[model samples]
Structure formats: C-alpha cells, structure tokens
Target: MNTVIDAHNISKVYNPTTIPVYAVNNVHLHLQKGEFTALVGPSGSGKTTLLNMIGGLDRPDEGNIFINGIDITKLSANELISFRLQNIGFVFQSFNLIPVLTAKENVEFIMQLQKASKQQREERVKTLFAQIGLQDKLNERPSRLSGGQQQRVAVARALASRPQFVLADEPTANLDTKSAFNLLDIMAKLNMEENITFLFSTHDQRVIDRARRVITLVDGRIVQDTAEVSTQHEEAAAVKT
Candidate 1:
C-alpha cells in the first residue's frame, strides 16, 4: 500500500473533566510514500500533538492511527514501544544524541536494541554517515560536533532502522540559517533519491519552502493542504507561499 500513515477522526483533549480543551479536534490525514510534507501553523495549532499521535508517542482520545495497516492507537503500551522501535523514526528539535556515545555509536544504538548483527550495524552506520556527508565525524561525540553536524547525525540515526516514515518535529528550530538550509538540502536529496518519506512539524519558513506538500493547521484543524505536481522548476516556485 502507498499510504504509510492513515489517521481517522483523531482527537486529543486536555482536562476533559473540567475546562475541556481540544488539542486536536477530529482530524483525518493520509500520507503516501515518498512524500516530503510539512505540517505548519501558529503556536497551539496541534502540530506537535498530531505528530506525536501519528508517531505512536501519544494516543488520540477518539480515533485510530494506522501505520502501514497496523492500528497503533489500539496497541498496548509494550506493543506500541516495540512497534515504534521497528516502524517509526523520530527527529526532534534538541538533537537528542547520547552524551557519552560517539556519532557512530549513537546511530547504531537503535540497531543494537533490535539485535542487528555487528556487520549489519557497522555497514548501515557507514552507509548512513556517507549519505549525510559525515564520514569524518563518525567517531566524534555530539559535544565535539557543531549543531548542524550533530543534527545530521541525528538524521542518520533516525534512518538506521529503515522506518516506514520519519516524523521530525521542529528539527530546524534551533539551527542557524545556513545550517537549516544545509539540513534541508540533505533531506531533500534523500527524499528524491532514496524515496524516504518525511513528515515535519515546523514553524521554520526554510522548511516550509522546501516541502513538496504543505498541510496547514489552525485551531487544531487542518485549514489547508497544498501539493506541488509539476516540473522540477515549477515545483520549486510553487511552494513559495
């Protein structure tokens, strides 16, 4: 199936017993393979909330989220954890790398949890670092690398297990302009060459500009969803809103 994500009538409410506030209110979404999509809106628009639910980090109160035909919202806690490990990749704003681990080690950690063979881990890490143009920094720790380099390592880590799709929440929020553009370049290359799907929750205009599909949210609902289906030059110009 082409649909990697299918969310139906999903809703999340905070303080439902008292001052009920709907963080995500009955939203439906579907993402096909190879899509580079941006979920954007103002603060409190439920971008992160919806992303978390789709990534299996949080559950919607009212509906189901299906990832590759599996209903993640119905999975038990332990089942959900295992499912996420195998099927979902996450890139967060903080560049969440292990402090003591080297770049190679940090990327390989998830593979270790899945009990990948040493050869498999080593080869996968090598390929990912090469793809992200960070072969020299493989042995360096997160503290030794610059913010952009660290974020590249984080991207490598996210791709280690070959997740169905990647969910990145404000990945460029802490990056400088040059760094953000560099990261976007790498991600766009991956999306085009490797057909890796990415869904991002971001307020950064740099990210929004590069996305092939843009989903806008307002007050916990999807207000607009625009896609570009044209020649390369035309697609580049189309997302410039």
Candidate 2:
C-alpha cells in the first residue's frame, strides 16, 4: 500500500521562550492508503494538535508533514488551502453545517467548492445520502435532524469531495450507543468498499474498538501503535485452538 500521510519529527510548543509546553514532540507517523486509524490519548496528550498539524489547520514549530509525498509544511497559504480542500476531508465534533442549508445542500457544498459539475454533485449527494440512510432527510436542515442524523450528514459531506483521507475528530462524541454504532458501521463499510483512508482522534472505547489500528499518545509521544483485532476474532481463535 502507498503511504498516504507521512509526519516526520513533528514538534509543536505552545510557548517556546517561557515555560514551554510541548504539545507534540518528535512525533513520527505514517498512514497507508485505506487504513482506518485512531489516535487515542488522554486530554492534552497532543492528539488534537498533531491532528491539526496533519490536516493543515495548524503549523508545527518544527519538522515536516507530507501528504502523498508533497511536503504540506512548505506550501504557501493559498497553496496549502487548495491542497487541503482537494486532498483531506475534516469531520469535527461540532458537525459544522450551514444553519439554513438542507442536508442535501450541506453535502453538496464541498463539491461546489471543488467546481465539480452539477450532475456530479447531485449524483454523489444522492448516492452518499442513500448510503448513510439519509435519503429521506435530504431536504431537512441540520436543526431538524437528530444528533445522530446530523453526524451522518456530516460524514456524507466529508466524502463529497472524494478526498484521499478523512480526518475525524471526535465524530461520535455526541451520539448515543445505537447512533454511535450505526455511524461506526457506516464508516467501516465505506472504508472497506471505497478504500478511503480514515484517521480519527477519539477517546471513546466504542470508537477504539471499531478502529483497525490504534495509536496511543502520551504526553505528545506515541506510546503504542498496533494493529487491532476484533473480539470476534479472538473468540474464533480460541475455538480453533
């Protein structure tokens, strides 16, 4: 598999001169295409900071980040903005949507920014909404939908641009158990079917259990990076042995 994201010696400090708080320090990471990964850590472990650095939302004080071999840290403001728009999809905990826009409109917004054809945008929104079980709610605005539905729409919106990898920060933070499972099932299905890479930052065990790979961070350093096997796998192995 191709390396979709490469972070080399990344370091970020809140205040360098006086009482420096190192948010992230010497972090080296790489993500392969189609991999579903979660960065789990305690509060202030630099998960969000590292995620921001990878997403081009924040710049690191030192080191470089590469997406598909392009050094994003070296790009100009406009260039980086364009790159991020085209390559990365972001899903924040807030489910940021235009208040007045319908779910369909919200999902279409990304492709509109990409200058995709109207036919393409419409087709994608239709398919994505259907895939996420939101086809019936297409005309409804965000305020009209439930928390779970809103998050589903947000997931649909993230995939609208057909980005290389999706960065989701606390995607299921507000969902109930059923909703969270539903969202995770949808995302996992999409990952398998479309081979879309997903890198999410979360602390929830439900999210952690669903992830294929778990990367744990402690005090801004990755303490654990290992492939994850589901409970079903463990049970099956026990029976076999």
Candidate 3:
C-alpha cells in the first residue's frame, strides 16, 4: 500500500501544568492512498485533536506525523502552514465558505494562493464544480444555496488544491438526512472514480455506514479498526489460517 499518512506515538496534552488532560495518547495511525476511512468516537474522545495534528493545524506534544514521508512535527510555524496548503484539504462542520465569494470564486481561492495561473484556476474550478454536480450553482453565493449545495461547494474547495487527502470533521452534522446522504454519495463516487483518499472525523451514522473502514477511538485511544473484507482477502486469510 502507498501510505500517505503515518503518525507514530503521537500525543496531545491539554492544561499540562494544571489538570493535565490527555487529548490523545500515544496513538499510531497510518492511512493509505485511496482509502475511505471514518474515525468514530464519542465527544471528548480526541478524534478531532488527532485529525488536526495530522492536518498540521496543531502539533503533537510528543511524537511525529509524516505525510507522504515528510515529518511535519519538526516544521517551523510558517513552514507548517505552507506544507498544509500544499498537502492537506479540510472540510469543517460549519461550512467555512467566504461569505462574499460565489461558489466558483470560493473554489478558486486556494489555487490562487498557491500561485496557480488564472487559466489554471478557472479550468480546475469548472471541472470540480462539474464533478460535484454544482456547475449550475457556480455563480451563487453560499447564502443563495441550500445546506447541501453549500457543502458541495465546500468539498470542491477542499479538492481544489489537489491535496494528497481530505480531512472532513463532522461534515454531515449540519444537514438533514437527505442532504447528508446526497453529500456522502458525491464523496463516495469521487473516492471510487478519482482514487481520492478521505479520512472523516464524524459521529454521524450516515458517514460511518458509507466508510470502507471504521476506526473507533475511546478515551484518546484506538479501540477497534475494522475494514470491509473483499472475497480475495477473506480467502487469503482462510488459507493462511
């Protein structure tokens, strides 16, 4: 497997001098390319903390995170931001779209920061909008779209940078059942057809049900790692046993 994320013995401690809470404790996680995985946990289970560390939004108090074989824990603050812009994509629960920009402009914003040519940005935005089935809403602002449509635009923005993987934190939390399902369908199709890797930090059953692998974290520790087994994998395991 081509491992895109390798986190080793990572820990995040909060209020270290006082209460000393362990948000994440010595967690080891590895994600391969093209895998659709869900990180499931109850609130306060440290799943979001772990995801943020992996995405370089925060650094671990101890241990290392390697994305595509580069250790991010050692990077300086500015370097970390640059690395994240190039390597990771994030979709938050709140649908953090710029209020003024249209869907097309919102998606193009990141590529512009990366210094992509105007033509490159425009072409990529069109292609992504088409892929997300939001071509018609390209000119609509977030306020003009439904919750689902806004989230789709968020997904397109996340993909605009062509990052190695997408990290979604409770992306379906704000939507109704229908909207949640629709978003999941689009994400699953993208994962299957485009070989995009997604790691979701969510408690939504809708998201969990669609994931190829489900990882359960409890009290800042991984308690279960389960993946759907294909026929070949089942047969091979039987033979080995």
Best by TM-score: 3
Task: Show how many residue pairs clash in every candidate, following the order shown.
Answer: 0, 0, 0
User: What's each prediction's TM-score?
Assistant: 0.93, 0.93, 0.95
Error of 3 at 124 (Å): 0.8
| lDDT tens per residue, model 3, 24-114 | 9989898999999999999999999999999999999999999999999999999998998898999999899998999999999999989
Q: Using alpha carbons, what is the TM-score of model 1?
A: 0.93
lDDT of 3 at 86: 93
Which parts of model 2 are misplaced by more than 4 Å? Answer: 227-241
- Shift in Å, residue 173, candidate 3: 0.3
Query: Please, what is the whole-model Cα lDDT of each candidate in the order they appear?
Result: 0.93, 0.92, 0.93
Candidate 2 per-residue lDDT over residues 83-140, each given as its tens digit: 9889999888888888899999998988999999999999999899989998899999
RMSD of model 2 against the true structure: 4.0
